[model samples]
Target: MTVLPNNLVFRSITGPEELELFNRLPYVQNDELADDLARGRRRPSWMWMALDGDRLLARLSWWCRPQDDAPFLLDLIDVDDSAHDVDRCAVAEQLLRTANAALFPDGVPVAQGTPPPEFLRFVPADWRADESTRRMVEDRVRAVERSGAVPLVERLRYEWFAGYPVPRPSDRLRFRGIESTEDILGLMARALDGTLDAHDRLDLQERSAEEVAAANFADEFANYDTPRTWWRVATLPDGEPVGFVIPARNAYHPIIAYIAVLPEHRGHGYIDDLLAEGTRVLAEEGVPNIRAATDVGNVPMAKAFERAGYDTISAVVNLTWEK
Candidate 1:
């Protein structure tokens, strides 16, 4: 094989060790991102690059599956916002070329190959707020367009960090973990009321709430990396159920797998009790961080997450085809 050089260059590096440098770059969610890649849930195509002497920037990441000759995912197209001297377009092109070589199913490059991999470039809506960021995104989008793929999915990435004091135990609400399967299914049915989210709506495909609960359990709950025993359900002293939270780790990150308050329970501060109890469970386990997200349009629940100290890491906008 022949190696090449450039005046302003970027190239691919194999294995986790070389990848670590890019992964550690500022603003990269290193550990959590690595967890996604390692699990085969996300893969970087070439781990693309840009350089001018010791100064460097990243342009795009392509996650592909060689078996299907498919481009599966793309993300983390970030850079040091202050470093605006380099040619953003050229950097995007060069980095994408690296992805072609390293990720092409037959070891071919995009320039001489079937075409560029179609991918999703995630950015906080503020990406184009400045020249460098805008240029970087523009060039990448143009490159993909030129390569015969569409700039398909656009999403928002949210974040929260720094210190958040745990809520003081509320006098009106007390919490405890659920113990038996029967109780879990019971609460889940009540929580189902007034739910408009897509995942919950999937419950309609089944004949009963128990069936709905079972399907949700297998697809989501059964796959968690954290203990189910940590899940909590909230209730009133008169034995009425209000809300619940299931804190667990999935393939992506540690998360609140499920949190809902019955429709009748909405507007009251019952959500605060549920959020605190859920977050407290993870905090008590000493997990350094947890990741969770909901529909951007779900205003109140989103607010609840912020109050409970969850910074939105990213927004997943879904697309589907059906009958």
Candidate 2:
């Protein structure tokens, strides 16, 4: 428990009896909370809130995959929107610092996902042009920063709907099902050589590229609820591998789990072909929407998603705290 100003108290939910109290905060949907609890992605002890005489002032929660003993990310942090900016920031910073210290004493790296751009649009006009919304977002970010977290990268979330016009397949490359885990792992290694992925780049600072690639492979495979047959490798006429794509369903929806262009084949514009094949796979399955995300700074990949007719639905900001 944490002691706060004015006799405020910070504590975790004791059990299922506090579900309504946990869901009372804005931002998270009640149904989503119920689903997460039912699936074991969330636990009562992982949800913490700061209260001033039963009034919720701030809250933070961690989410993990089903059956995981430890949380993988801190996905939600909310402060009362009506509070003064300074007060809101103070509550947020204190809540995060104290909760993190208690929940992650070993200093595990925890990640935070900002609400998607569309979700943040409380008013109808463009959110980017909305000053009030922008300031509120910045304040939330600063609060996280005050807790010693750093911005890892900004990401673009894209969605392809059933009715959208999918790009015609490019004849420059041919696609085939992934033949073996070893071959896919090999391509993953090659994909990291000159990767533009911010997370991959950050990991490379202290670990070998191969080690980082292996870690990524394991993490990604763990979340894939769909069949491995959905994975594909793109190649040229001479049977040279150009790239690979993992079009699979995650815990919730169909997603382009991973897509990459080989370092040697990157500049040749083979990514568009890979994107097309990945989209076609999900589109052919009649999925209502296919979601994918790329680092905001990865212009080429972002352009490829756009060229494939995926809409830029939102932007996700990731803040990380590492031991």
The global C-alpha lDDT for each of the candidates, from Candidate 1 onward, is 0.61, 0.77
Error of 2 at 79 (Å): 0.7
RMSD of each: 7.6, 4.8
Error of 1 at 250 (Å): 3.7
Candidate 2 on 1-323: residue-level lDDT in tens? 22246777889988767777776667734557777877888888788988887788888777787645677667777777776533788887888777877876654433343221111111212345778867766767788888667777878888889999876677988888888877888888889998889889988888987788788877777457688888889999888999999999877789999999999887888888888888888888889999999887899999999888888877776777653
TM for every model, in the order presented, reads 0.59, 0.88
Give the TM-score (vs. native) of candidate 2: 0.88
Q: After best superposition, candidate 2 residue 252: deviation in angstroms?
A: 1.3
Which lDDT tens digits does candidate 1 get at residues 1-323?
Answer: 11222555566545556556666455444566565467554455446666555556654565543232354455445554455565454455456656655566575334444334445554455666777666756765665554445433443343333256665447676566786877787778766766656545644554476677776776567666677789987878776777788988755456777888878888887877887787778777776676666665567777777777666665443332121
lDDT of 2: 0.77
